[model samples]
Every structure is written in C-alpha cells, then in structure tokens.
Target chain A: MIKDIMLISELGELALIEKIRGYFSIGDSGVLIAIGDDAAVFSADKKNIVTTSDLMSEGVHFDYTYTTFYQVGFRLVISNVSDIYAMGAVPSYLFLNMALTGKRSEEEFDDFLKGVREACEHYNAKVLGGDLSLSIKGDFYSATLIGFADRVKTRSGAKPGHNIFITGNTGDSAAGLAYLKYVKKRIPMEKNMEYTSREIDGTILDTVRRHLIPCACNPETFIDKIKAMIDISDGLLLDLYRICAESRAGALIYRDNIPVSDGVRAIASMLEMDYMDFVLSGGEDYELIITSDSDHLDDCILIGKIIKDGFFFVDSDGIREKFVPKGYTHF
Target chain B: MIKDIMLISELGELALIEKIRGYFSIGDSGVLIAIGDDAAVFSADKKNIVTTSDLMSEGVHFDYTYTTFYQVGFRLVISNVSDIYAMGAVPSYLFLNMALTGKRSEEEFDDFLKGVREACEHYNAKVLGGDLSLSIKGDFYSATLIGFADRVKTRSGAKPGHNIFITGNTGDSAAGLAYLKYVKKRIPMEKNMEYTSREIDGTILDTVRRHLIPCACNPETFIDKIKAMIDISDGLLLDLYRICAESRAGALIYRDNIPVSDGVRAIASMLEMDYMDFVLSGGEDYELIITSDSDHLDDCILIGKIIKDGFFFVDSDGIREKFVPKGYTHF
Candidate 1:
C-alpha cells in the first residue's frame, strides 16, 4: 500500500533525488556518465554537435493558472529543438533543469514529464539527462538541448544586395496577445466578428500553437547552400537589422512587400495600434528571415536588398529612410 | 531616461532574445552562427570533445539570505569546472542560463555577475555566451561547460584489482550544514568547544568552504594514464559501487583508511551522528575518486582495492564482507 503525504523538508534534497532516480533509465551508447555527478558526460563526434538553451520562469514566462503544466513542458522542449533547426541541424538529445514549486501537485509533475516524453518522440531527441530541484518560494524551469549539425549557416553571412525573405506571415503572436487582453478587459463585442473575441478564436489557437511548438526549418535538406539566415524571433524588421549588422551590410525592406496576415492586420486596426509596429517590434513568431545574393532572388523571395550603409526602410511612397536597431529586451 | 520598463510578457520570447543581440559584441572564432538564429553554429576539427552541465536552484541548492549572491555565482561556475577537471580535461568555454527574479536590485545583479566573472577567470574558461531570463519567483541558475580532452576516462574503464582512491576528505558540507542549523536554532556555540553546536562553528565554516570551492585536479594532466574515474559526489562508497558496476568489478574499501578532517569529525561528534554516515552518504563534495591498476597510491591515498566479485564492504569490526550496492541518487 502507498501513502499519500506532503512535507519535502523531512526528506531533504538527497532523499528526494533518490526517490526520483528510479523513474529514469539510462540509454546505451553515447552517454559516458548520466547521473549522480556534477554534470552529464556525453560522447560527441565532430560531424555533428548542436546545443541550445531556453529559460522559462513562472509568472514571467508561464502562468500555472492559464497554461497547463503539460503545455509548459512541451514548449520547453520545442524551444531548444527549434534552435537546432535554426542551425540547419537535426535534434538529438536534451538536458533539462527543472526548478519546481513547493506546492506543486504530483499530478502536475506527472503531466509535465509526460509532455516532455511526447516532445522527445515528436522530434526524435533523446532525453539523456537532467537535474531537478525544488525552488525556495516560487517555481521556474529551464532546458538545454544538444543536437547534431553537419554544415552550419550563420546570420553573419548576409551580404549587400542579397535578397531577404521569411518563412511565414508575421504578427501572429502579437495579435493573439492583444486579443487575449481585449477579452480580459470584458469589452462588449460581436460574436463571430473577424477581429472580435469569438472570430479571432482559430487565429489565436494557431498563434498559440506556433508560439508553443516552434516550427523549425528542415535544416538537413537545405542548410548547405544557404548564405545568411536568422530565425524570425524578433520582428522581421529587427531580425533583418541583426543579420545586416553581423554581415557588415545594410538592408532596405519594402513596407508593402512585408508579409502581414489578414487576422494580424485586423487585430492591429481594432486595437488602434500601428500594423507596422506589430510587424517590426512584435516577437515570439519563430520564422526564418533569410538572405541570399541578388542572383539567388528566384531561389528565394526578395523582401529587400542589403546595402553597405546600415538598416534602411523603403515605404510605399518609395522614400528610403534609416531605422533604429532595437529588438526584444528582457532587462 | 529609462522611461520604458520592459516586461517580458510584453515582448514575448523572440523580441526578448533580439533585445540582447547588441550585447554580443565579440566575434566567436569557432562560431558559424551566433544569435538571431535557431541555434548558434560552432565548428571544430575532428577530435573527441568533452561536455558537461549543472543546474543550481534557489532554495534547494542555496540560500540567498546567508549566501552572498557573488558566492553563489562563483560556486555555480566552480561546480561545473570541477566536473571537467574530474575527467582530466581543460575547460575551454561556458554557456550560462541565469533566471533572475528580474526585480533584483542593480547592486545584487552586479555582485552576482562579478562572482561569475571572477570564477571564469580562475578556471581559465571563457564565457562564450549566455541567456538571461526573468524567472517566475525564485532565482534560477544553470551552466554548461565545454572542454577539450586529451585522454577521456570513464568510470567503467576500471579493471579488477585496480586500487581505488580519492583526492581529499569528505562530508565537510554535511558538517557545515549541521553547524548552520545549530546556529540558526539560536544555540550559543563557541569555536573549538566540545559541545555539538560549539564544535560546529569552525567546522561548519571550513566545511562550507569545501562545499563552495572544491579542490579540482587538472584532469587533462592525468586522465589519460588513469583507467577508470568518477567524482566523489554522492560519497566514496556509493561512487565506488558505480565504478565497480560499470567496469564489471568489485571493490573492498578500507574504512580505516578513509580520510576525515578533524573539523568534520568534531561536528559529527557534537551532533551525536555517525561519522561513517556523514563520510559515506554525504553528497556534493565534488572531489575526484579514481581507480588505476598502476599503483599510484602516493599521488592519492589508496582507500580500497577492486575485486573480481560484484560488491564487498569493510565494516566497523574490521572485517570485509559482501553487501548491496550503494551510491547517491539524482532524480
């Protein structure tokens, strides 16, 4: 018979770890040292090595009330793998560090680990090892994934006159967040209206999906010939600025040519916020903002041309102007 | 004049990453791609690589109230490097993921970073890159260190009859903790006094030092010659079990030969606790426990000998006997 009880201070950290160790079994090969050490040792080869990390805090990065503990676990895995994909690499293994809240329910922990196991199967990355600890007062989570990359591409390779392109429409997450705020405000609105609370349901769901399960570019099949690339994390405009800065070139993006989804534009209009601000400053829509030479424009869509000066913008009036170099800031 | 306060929720994840892009000023030589991408790209010549990681949570691992933030930062860096040292590798670089309370006083943040910077310099490991996130509530910290190994050693590499040894005495941390607890209980204590709480003062301070800055052996200098190795993290007896289990060997530890500091002993005596329990099961000592057939007892005091069987024990009665396997556990 099993007894259900609470009171972690009685067991302490060492006993707690021992209790949890039974659940994890080591995989054969590649892992030299798995657990019970200061760190996990892995057998790595030169042909492929990938590493990325993400931090998810409680109130800042997640809310236990709104987001189920399971969704948080799934997104944590994807965030790391998404980095591997951005490197034009395949996902392989992961190492997680979980800082748990004292009041966390056992069911919540079970669901959280289940979410991790599911993501591992989805991406084929092995959950090699991790460290688990209890927080003092509040809860937090972080993860680092090590992947495999053969030939890698970087953001510093963008050149002047190179065509800049992106994978999908921008402003999804930004608009969805605005919609959430509007709904929370209890503002009266029509049912089934496009930008209203109900009509925006599907778009918000899709945005949430995109925000959570970050879609990675198929790096294995396409990374070899790529010149300069970046994940569209910061808005397209800001990401372009980074690519240009590192590559020692400037870019002039045509405002009309930028991809802004219908739902995104409608939300921006409803909120009386500039569509361009969502397109320029809004973040978390993980897409690829890539650049290739002018000759390769047919190979990729031409959003703008990289110039020698710095970040530039071309409006619908055909007037070219300079733009500030600001992206997302946590501090 | 810093009028705009950036809430992580307002910017989301991508824009937050973009906001920090300007801070990455130095060009990484091995980097094929840095920030603003899915994963940072790194290139290297075909060679065996050593990688390790560790996580430090707020309450479980440390107390910010008594422990200076700088010491906590320094200790985190020290802990990861010690693992690399245990493998006989020269640490090359590090990647840090620090989750801040975000509402930290500037003084606190600066002190913490200073600790990190100083530790990096001490270990000769460059801080190549890092991620800073606003945590939910507690301060969360984790680090991954990459090192180059000339001759990597595994715990399973031990052969039958190899001598087992450790670098230094153990259980200092437990002694320190006991002392800290006694002091916290408002027990009046004097340094060098025979009282359990009294003997704890000096012993606790010394043990606390051992807990923070462990003696790290330059593993690269000796790992090639060593047959099997593991850090004495969980305890000497437990770690010996791991080496024997992996190497398909057995070990007989000479309990009388095990090293114990006077301070550790004093604390144990005062607490009316078994000295062997503190030495046998105490975790986080971070000293290297090695096994080699070459008979290098002078280099490190020999504590045991490998046998052909599965497991054996040297008891308080000075008789050797068979027993169940033991070690520290991490969930």
Candidate 2:
C-alpha cells in the first residue's frame, strides 16, 4: 500500500508554520516569545552566550537517496550543538532556516520536523523561531544554536605538555558510509519500510546508525580541567592541526592509541580500505578533542600530547612521522 | 573592456575565508572570540539577548537579473536587523551562512561581502563567524543577527484603544520593483558596470534605492511605551493583521493616513495601477508597524487605532470597508 503525502504549498505558509509550531512545546521558563512573533525572546541568565550557525545544502552536504529527511534534520541539530559542547557550553536555543524546492511531500517535511523536535528535546533546547523560503534547486537547512557557559573553552589555550584526549570512538561514520556503498545495491527494496528499519547486516547497521546519529560530547562536566577543545567535523588530523595553529603549539598523536570500533574495522576490511585512513581523516565524527593537564583524564581516551612546534604521529614501530593536514573543504 | 571574473574554486576555501576576514575590524570590546573558532563567543552584558535569523535564496527571495550582488547582501542585513529593531533591541553581532554554487566570480562575491560589511558598520554590529558550503544551484545567504535589549516588545501585548504607528514610508519597494520591470527592457547593457550605477530616471532612482537599502527603524527610544510591534516585510495590511491575530485585537486603519511616496504614486499612475494596492500588500519594505499608547507618539506617523474585534479601513469619504489580509508567501 502506498502512503499518502501532502505538499507544503497546499497548507499555505501560515498553516505550515502553525503545523511546525505544533511539533514543539515551548513552556520553557526562559523562552519569552517563541513562534508567531517578529523575533523570539529569551533571557540570557547572566552567562556568556556562544553562537554558531551551519548550512547544509543538497548535493553539497548530503545526498537524499541514501539518507532520510529525519536524519537530515537530526544531524543538523547534532552538528550545531556539537560546536556548543566543544566550548563547554550548554545549548539552550535553536533558530532553524529551511529553503525548500516545493517538491517535498508533507510527510517528508513532517518527519524532518519531528527529527528536529526530538533532537531539541534530547539536548534540553527550544526552537525559538526561523524563516522558511522556497528554493529553486533543492532543500537547504541552516541551523543557528545559542548556548551559555560561565567559563568557555576556546582553541587558543592549549599549551605544550598538555595531554590530548578524545571522547568516544572515531572512524565509525566513514565506515558507515563505506558499508552503505557496499550493500546498497544488494538490499531488497521495500517501499513502506523506513531506512532505519530495513533489514541489514548487524555489524554494518551499527556503523550506519553511528553515521546517522553521531553523538556530541558534553565537556561541561570537566570543563575546568580542559585547556582547549574542538569538535571533530573535518577529521581528526585537520581539527588537531587547527588547535595547534590557533594555540601556537603542536601535537604528537599515538597511532595505536586512537579509538576505532570493531564494526568500523570490519566494514573497512569488507570494503578493502585502510581503517586507519578513516580513523585519522574521516569527517563528521562529531566527537570532542580536548587538550588538558594529565591530572584530568577521567572519561576520555588519551591519544596524544601537545608539543612545542610540529605535528607528528608516533607509529607502532616507535618512529615519529611528520603529519600533513588534509580534510574536507566546502569549496 | 570586459573585466576579469574569478571563480570560487580558484581561490579555495581557506584563502576565501582569509579574504573575507580582512573586510571587517573586530576590536569591539564585547567580542570575546570572533572568527577562526568552532563558534563565536560574545558578552551578553547581563541584558536579554534577542536573536533572529532569516534566509534569502536566489530565484526565490531575489534575482540577479534586476538586482546587484551588493544590493542582495545589503538588503539581507537590513531585513535581519529590522527584526532585531522590531523587538526594540540593538543589533550587535552577525553570523552569516552562504551556500555557493562554485560558479560565482571573485569580484561579485567581494561586492556582496562589501555590502554586508557596510551594513554591519551602519548598525554597529560585528560579524563574528559563519559557515560556507557548496550549493548545487544558485547562492543562498542565511544570516543570524544577535541583539541586546533591556525590555522587549512582543506581538501579544496590543490592546484595544492603542494607536497604530509606522516608521518611514511604505510601497516604495514594490513601486521600485515595478519600475525596474518597466525599464529593464529599454536599458542598454554596459559591460563591467554595476546595475546601481546604470542610468535611470531620477524619480524612480530614489525608490529603487529605497528598495535596495531599506532602512530599519530603531524603536529603543520609545520601547517602553510600545505595546506591540512587527516589521513590515509582508505589506501593511497583512502585517497589521498579524499583530491583530497575535494580540487578539482588530485594527482600524485610515486609508489616507497610510504613507505612500511621490515616486510610488507617479509610477502607479504611469503603470495604471492603484498606489494603495502596493502600499497595502507590498513586501520587503523593512519598516516597522507599531502599536503604542497615544502618549508615546514620537518621531512616527500615526496611521490607525487598535479595535476590539474586526479589521476595517476607513476611506477618505468616511466609508468603513472590511480589510481582507493578503500578502507575500513562500509557497
């Protein structure tokens, strides 16, 4: 049986906004005005505000054939919230901007909104308000996140002799992409089943879920112990290089100490690719990389140490190799 | 002679960011961390922070054929800053998001950035940081503006007997658009010359400039007396209807009191159209429509009065006509 789909145009702009407003409950104590206003108002609560925005465009940041609208919306919030967490701040508000091509079904858009609502609830954040417009080519989703922190961490405070640590595992998102490429052609089609519910290999499924719902690190618990921090969006090597360049320092990473999941390794082997490449240079991991004193290695993997000058990678053979930075570029 | 045009791919991402960074000076005492970080951090100064974001997509919100890149960027800042001012806040910082199709010339992008910088300076706002990505079709510019205010004006506070007021003139933008459409077929193209510098009739030129650089109304001077407020993006009657719907009140607008410019009147006559239609339904004026007590009418044009139930327009002949809400919609 085919499912019924509705177009946003049929609902009109005001009705569409009303529908979106219905998805979010905004009784939060700080939100003064949420939807249906010129601008949303909220209290700052006497803390420094950290603001960030990111844009994801069709055919540039995503391909809808392999992903769903829900994942698109969910990942946008996660990606933006990750930046706030990187600064040891708690995300409090979101302003979403969506440009649609007018070809989307109402169900798809609803699923996208549901994903956004769920993500906001997960992070204790509220959707203040945003603008929606029509696009000529494809969909564009831009998210602006506002966060608060008493003391914020920046990328310019890492000093020499600080230990480098990363929360959770890396390379799983890249492995998920590789696994999807390998098995996409072999999977049987089921029109009614959602992508997440489709039957797949268990090992590959885990990695795929990791790609779809990449976790964000909350460094607020140990913010005082951390010196500098950044999110791993453009791969580990490139982000580490950014920390080094910003702080006027360098890093020495231990290759064996880097965290790589078993599912990622298995998928990399199945795809005939080097797992270390994914671990070192894969983007969109959304994990936090922190530079801290040795006394504060509580809930993270200690993978390296800050150096005085040049970036290096210590191999299993006990030889240090100079590392060159290369990763994703929007251009 | 034809001028040289450089594509974004030739400059790469990092160099493009560096070039963009050079356009603005960031010695503002409020900015703790500007660009080159995961997110931008600024001091909120113990005041309520007002945040708003709007997206302008090519072929939807604007067209390159009739408008210049500089105008596009300038209008974007104006439109966003208007929202801040509508909330009776002072715009302080900007986070810009651009999605390029990799086909834009260097000079064109520079012109757009120049417009943004000038607008920022004009409003005493600083560009903190933003994200850039590739687009499949045309360019998309999404801006998030942060402002500060001691008190805020929302659309839910207008009560019956409150006087309706507006800042500056309306309908000029729509008239300018009509004039552009009228003269575009007659003008001869000059290579390498910007559209704003092109020859045009003086009467229409002022209206066109009004459309391009729409001014925002700063209401902080009398925010304490304002009951409800909204920016006039989607016509006079429609936005008034929004204020009415949100505040649960109706409005009685005097048709003769609606501010229409001389250039708009002339163009309306030449085009055989009603100038009031443009005044009632034109979008992109970026002016403020405010409702306040009679005691706080300072530096504004009084146009109407809030009523208890239904919207009506009183003609010069003293006939009350039911006002139906109609304006721009994305769909």
A1-331: candidate 1 lDDT, tens digit per residue: 8655443333433343343233223434344333332123343554645567677887766555545666677767776766667666677656666766545655566557666666766787655444555566666677777666565566678777677776677777666656655655322221122333454455455554454444554545445556777666556776777677667788888767778776677677878888777777777676677776534432344567777876677888989887886655554
Model 2 over residues A1-111: C-alpha lDDT tens digits?
975544332333334334434423344335443433212334466556677788899877777777777778888988988988887778877778888776665556666
**CA deviation > 4 Å runs, candidate 2:** A1-46, A181-199, B1-46, B182-199
lDDT of 1: 0.63
Candidate 1 per-residue lDDT, tens place, B207-287, comes to 656654444555554455578877765666776777777678888887777888877888788788887777877777777
The local distance difference test score of model 2 is 0.74
Model 1 docking grade: incorrect
The lDDT of each candidate is 0.63, 0.74
Clashes of each: 9, 1
lDDT of 1 at B116: 71
- Every candidate's fraction of true contacts kept comes to 0.28, 0.44
